[model samples]
Target: MCSTKPIGILDSGFGGLTVVGEVIRQLPQENILYVGDNARCPYGSRPPEEVRKFLFEIIDFLVAQEVKMIIIACNTATAAGLEEARQRYSVPVIGVIVPGSRAAISATKSGRIGVIGTENTINSDAYRRELHRINPRLTVTNRACKPFVRLVEEDLTDTEEARRTVTAYLQPIQTERIDTLILGCTHYPLLAPVIAEVMGEGVALINSAEETAREASTVLSVSQQLHDQNPQPQYKFYTTGDTEYFRQIGGRWLHRDIEVASVALGG
Candidate 1:
């Protein structure tokens, strides 16, 4: 893969823009190509095998676009297919779980960390496993917030419904008295305000997007794949669903105009 080729990112839907934003902030010279499988979104509820299939489809599409690296920006997809993806693809494949777990580990003061994600992710026990792998002493509390993804996707993150939903979904984790919480799903970061309100000021919320972007930077730098010359890097977006909706949600979330094209995956 060429160093100047765009770095590819994919998610179940628009949630991956959080990672895209962070990458842009930290690695301004690098180009980005984002794909949101909006058609098969909320991979959190899907069977592991189905999620894995969709992930490979997206990865194949990204690789054809000649991305130098790939970021599985969806927690469900990451949990489902990260290892297989790394083995299947030549470029470095990074997932949100490990980075999120590491960030939660570093941010927690009480060693009690709470994690929230989609059903598939929480059920996969990926975060719990990664956290224990790093520090076996940690007390991990996990909750699957299924409705949270819909709230963010619908751009209802700051609504009253969003606040009530956040409160209900996070209350279980709140009782655990965790000093740090991992927004295990990339979509969850958009709901950070309501989540922070419900969890109160004591818990530090770890957005895996930021950590994942940093990891991508390290991988590129160490491999001499960093694109050093282009200050005006281009960004391309594709969706396996509604292009118009993708453009709208993506533009709103990223605070920039997004031109999206539709793609067909799993052919």
Candidate 2:
């Protein structure tokens, strides 16, 4: 594999920009090709089969771009399709669940962990299973904040309504006395302040954005596929929804101007 080939990242929508932000921070030399299925934005409410199908469609698009590796940045898509994507693709495939699960397991002092994500991710039980796989005695509780994605997409993250919504969603999880909480969805990190306030200072919130980026770095290093010598790296963005909207949110998250183009997937 060529070290200079770009890494492909896919998400259900703008949420993946969270991962992109971290990747840009951690792997500055690497080129990134990101695609947001914003047209089908919240994959949380969809069926597993449908989500898997959509994931593969995006993966095909990424592969066509000649990406060196693929990162499935959506927790719901990672749950529904990570294993299958790994099996199908020749390139390295990384997902958020394992890194997030590992971080939660490593951070907890009480051995009790809480996870908040979309309904699909919570229902899939991916985080719980991954956490248990790492440490069987660890306890995991999950809450599905199905509306959090919408709050992020609509740019309502810092508003009073967001705080109220976050408080309402986190009330039960806080009662669990968990020492560590995993923001299982990529979008949830944007609401970290509200979540932290609701959960209090005792709980350590796990944002897998950085951890996932580290994992990707490790994978690239192990495969000897890192673009360490590349002084000028390219970053490209594509969306299935509105290009300008993706560009706006993505730019805000990445702290750089983004130009996004639309992608139409076949039926």
Candidate 3:
């Protein structure tokens, strides 16, 4: 059965735009409905239970919108709620962690990989567990770059402070000489350039957004639910924070003008 319903994507804030961009590129025929919980952004520092609560709230909103699939684009949310969300929701729920782990596993030649994500995600050891589950001998280094989320959310990626922060956070991982580095958090891709510079040519940066989008495409194709007839796909953006700010940042990242509406989720 073919379904034309929009694919729902949720992130703590603007980070998921990375996934949105990939989805637009890979699944251009599919409509997209995105929610960014900016008002309660940076789920990284929050407890697992709290992050799960926020994730379910946003997922409930997307489910009510009748989306065919839901992508939890936030690493922390995925670490906190991916399994539960899959069981709770009838629609297919995809997470950033597994796709990223698979991609990193494929990219690494030395059997050593580095994962950089939020505090909660790193603490949960989601990527480490996923990578090890695939290959027990693989050396997985995990770093919690919590401030990187704030930098991307605040649109400070191009600043010197951002570079310094990136260097500081990645220094330990750099010394480890991991052959592949997973940009575990969706937001971390926005800082790819600086991270690349700091980590140098030896480390391959794996952006989860691209892999996640590919996974979404594969899932829809396998299930025969892909929207193949839509030539002009519609996109809807909602944010719990400032609409204009989201529009501005999202437009800059997406390289096109986007219409954003303010939405308040949960009582």
Candidate 4:
């Protein structure tokens, strides 16, 4: 793959914008092509095999677009399909879970880290596995906050109900004495305010977005695949569902409104 070719990224929906924002912040010179599987979004609740299928579909689509590197920006999809994507695709395929796990390890003071994500993610124990892979002695607790995604997707992150939901979902983790909490799902970062409020000032809320970008930088550097020239990065967004809603909510998520085109599945 050419070094100057756009880096491809995919998420279940608009949540991956968090990852895109971080990439933009740290690697302004690199180009990116992003896709959100909005039509069949919320991969969190699906069966592992189904999630894996969806992930491959998205990755296949990105590769068809001639992506140099691919980032799986969704926790659920990463849990389901990252390894398969790596094996199936010729290019490097990276996921958010490992980066988030490493960040949690570094951020935890008490060695007790809590991760809140979708039900499938928590059940799959992806975070727990990776966190233990790094430090076997650390204590890890994972909970699934299924509603947070809907809240963020609906732009209800700051609502009173959002506050209540956050408090309810995170109370158990707080009582567990976790000093670090991983926003395991990319979508969860948009609910950081509510999460922080409930967890209080003591716990460190780790957003893996920046860490994931760092991983990308490391991979590119180690492989001598870094893009040196300041080329204008092209960002194309395709939504399987409502392109208009994606453009609206997603533009807000990125703090830069742009056009969103429609993408078909199994085409």
Candidate 5:
């Protein structure tokens, strides 16, 4: 496999830009090809079968593009399709759940952890299962913050309504007295400030984006696929929704002006 091939990343929507940002910061030499299924933005509320189908559509597209590896940046999609993706694809397939679970486990001193993600992710119990598979004595509590994805998609993270929604949704988790919390959804990290405020100083906030990026770097290094020669790495963005909206939100999140091409995936 050519090490110069871009790393492929897919998300339900713009939330995956969070992971893209980390990849850019950590692996400056590698090019990136990102696809956001913004037309079907909130995969969180969708059925597992539907999410899995959508994920494969994007993955197939990425595979066709001949990416060096594929990163499933959406928690719902990861929970629904990561295993099958690994089985189906020849290139490396990485998911956000395990990295986030491992980070939460490492950060928690009290053996109590909280996870906040989309409805599908929470219901899948992916995080809890991964955490307990490693340490069965750990206490894992999770909540489905379905609305948070919308807050990020609409670029409303700093608004009063975002704060209220975050606070209300987190009230139960707050009561758990967890010393660490995993922002299980890639989108949740964009609202980290508000989450940190709600959870207070004692609780550590785990941003899976960082951990996932690190894992990608390690995988590529071990496979001897790191792109060391490219200084001016390229970034390509594609969306299945409004190109203008994706460019607007994605550029803002990534802090760089980006060009987005529109794509349609058949059912």
Candidate 6:
């Protein structure tokens, strides 16, 4: 399928739009369909089996939309469901982990990398595996920051509570002598300043959303799926939970009006 068919991206919540926006910026002529499982978000907090089940339903929904490609924009979903989704679909299915992992490795200065993601992502050891797979001698340090998701969803990324919580949770990883830190979750990028402040000026923060978007562009190019259309491509957003909240937060993040259509997902 060509890019005219629309690329599908799924996130546990509003975070996936970070990746969607990047893709649109890079591939201006491409259409995109984004699905946010807001009804069952914080997949990071759920059991692995539950995450997998939710992802399957979402994947089926996207595939039925006749999307040409699928991006598992949620790190927890990628760790728990990417492989299964890839095998089950005929389209080119991609996940954020490998692309992000490779970018982290390439961006590191001392071969020491720190990763901060959701609990399930860290627990799955997905990033560590890919980082080490690329360079066996690389040092990887990971921490699971659970409350950050809530902080982001509640629009409290820069609040005092978030500040204290982030600082306390990340204090140990700061002194680990790591030069590169991967924001494994898209939601984490919203806290980049606080993270940079806590980790100091020297640590380079690699955003997986940006890297993952680049990967999608490369894949479409290689597969001859890149759309050659001239007209502006439209983006459709859907949420299984609160459409107004999703639109408000998503518009704030994307710096544009995001009209979210109601969806029934994860049943």
- Candidate 2 lDDT over 1-267, as tens digits, reads 538889999998877888998988899999999999988877878888999999999999999999999999998889888999988999999999999998887789999999888877888899999988878999889999988988987889989999999889889888888999999989888899888888889999999887899899999998899888877778999999898878887888888897788899857
Cα-based lDDT for every prediction: 0.90, 0.89, 0.92, 0.86, 0.91, 0.88
Across residues 1-267, which tens digit of lDDT does each residue of candidate 4 receive? 328878898998887899999998888878888889988877767788988888888888889988889999988888888888888999998999999898888888889999888887888899999999889999988898989888987789989999999988888787888899999888888888888888899999988787898888888878877777866666788889998988888888899977889988765
Which regions of candidate 6 are displaced past 4 Å? none
Clashing pairs in 3: none
Q: lDDT at 22 for candidate 5?
A: 98
For model 5, what is the error of residue 42's alpha carbon versus the real structure, in angstroms, after optimal superposition? 2.7
Better of 3 and 5 by TM-score: 5
Error of 2 at 215 (Å): 0.7
Query: 4 or 6: which has the higher TM-score?
Result: 4
Cα error, residue 240 of model 3, in Å, equals 2.2
Scored against the true structure, residue 194 in model 3 reaches a CA lDDT of: 96
Name model 5 segments beyond 4 Å from true: none
Weakest ten-residue segment in model 4 by summed lDDT: 226-235
Q: Any idea what lDDT model 6 has?
A: 0.88
> Model 5: per-residue lDDT, tens digit, 38-101?
8987787788899999999999999899999999998888988899989998999999999988
Error of 2 at 137 (Å): 0.9
Q: What lDDT score is found at residue 120 in candidate 1? A: 75
Better candidate number, 3 or 6, judged by lDDT? 3
lDDT of 6 at 265: 68
- Residue pairs in collision within model 6: none
Question: Could you arrange the candidates by lDDT from highest to lowest?
Answer: 3, 5, 1, 2, 6, 4
Q: What is the C-alpha RMSD of each candidate to the true structure, in Å?
A: 1.9, 1.7, 1.8, 2.0, 1.8, 2.0
lDDT head-to-head 4 vs 5, winner: 5
* Clashing pairs for predicted structure model 1, backbone only: none
Clashes of each: 0, 0, 0, 0, 0, 0
What TM-score, to 2 decimals, does candidate 1 have?
Answer: 0.93
Q: lDDT by residue for model 3 over 88-160, one digit each (tens)?
A: 9999999999999999888899998999987777888999999989899999899989799789877899999
Give TM-scores for every candidate, taking all chains together and pairing residue i with residue i.
Answer: 0.93, 0.94, 0.92, 0.92, 0.93, 0.92
